[model samples]
Target: MAVDKDTVAGIAKLARIKVDDAEQEALTKELSNILGWIDELGELDTEGVQPMTSVVEVQHSLRKDVIKDGDRQDDILKNAPESKQGYFVVPRVVE
Candidate 1:
């Protein structure tokens, strides 16, 4: 795909970037070079190749799920700077 000056100007407008008339020519050439490289990559053969998330082999260690929290309300409330009616009190913001 060839990137012209008008195409670069359109891209600049869409990205909300201000590109001067002098800079547009340089930018258009740079963008064209990048696209040419991408086109070269598309010509590679990848028959029977498996996609991988990472280069290294890894396994996650997991534990069994269990419910606990066994009644420690008074112990938790002791650390609070301000508590009211078994709950931590925060400063009111809304009127």
Candidate 2:
């Protein structure tokens, strides 16, 4: 995974980033080093390893689903500036 200056330039063009000759050289080295580290990680033995979302064990508590209309019309309508027939009264938008 050795990144060359031409590869760095192509990447910069695809990303729409302006990279001068000096910056391209620097980025080439950086990208090569990062890929080399990834290659090193690929060589490690990962047998009998379980993939986990978190290091600590967690138990999620869930409640029973129950649906019911909230019977608080008068209490809710009290907060409105104006209400008529158990509904908020707003100015007519259409002529």
Candidate 3:
């Protein structure tokens, strides 16, 4: 796709960026080159290539699922300035 100066200016406006008149021409050429490279990539042939997560063969080390409380009730409540039976006491702001 060919990118013109006007197109670059419009893109800059949509992105809320200020592009000088001299800079727009350079940006237009750079965008055109990027699009040309993308077009070239589209011409590659791939008959039966499967999608893969990693290029190298390696398995991720995973641990078994274990659930437990990280903190004790007494330890957590000790830091509170005012703690009730088993919770923190805070002033009510709403009526």
**TM-score per model over all chains:** 0.46, 0.44, 0.44
Compared with the true structure, what per-residue lDDT tens digits does model 1 show for residues 4-93?
999999999999999999999999999999988888866788788887877878787787788666688889999999998999999996
lDDT of 2 by residue, 1-95 (tens): 78899999999999999999999989999999999888886787888987788877789789878776588999999999999999899999789
Clashing pairs in model 3, backbone N/Cα/C closer than 3 A: none
Compare candidates 2 and 3 on lDDT and give the better one. 2
Model 2 misplacement above 4 A = 44-95
Model 1 C-alpha RMSD to native: 10.9
Model 3 worst lDDT window (10 residues): 63-72
Error of 1 at 81 (Å): 35
Candidate 2 is scored at a TM of 0.44
Better model by TM-score, 1 or 2?
A: 1
lDDT of 2 at 53: 80
lDDT on C-alpha atoms for all candidate structures: 0.89, 0.91, 0.90
> Top model by TM-score, which number?
1
> After superposition, which runs of candidate 3 have C-alpha atoms over 4 Å from their true positions?
44-95
Off by over 4 Å in 1: 45-95
Which model, 1 or 2, shows the larger lDDT? 2
Q: For model 1, what is the error of residue 50's alpha carbon versus the real structure, in angstroms, after optimal superposition?
A: 10
Error of 1 at 9 (Å): 0.5
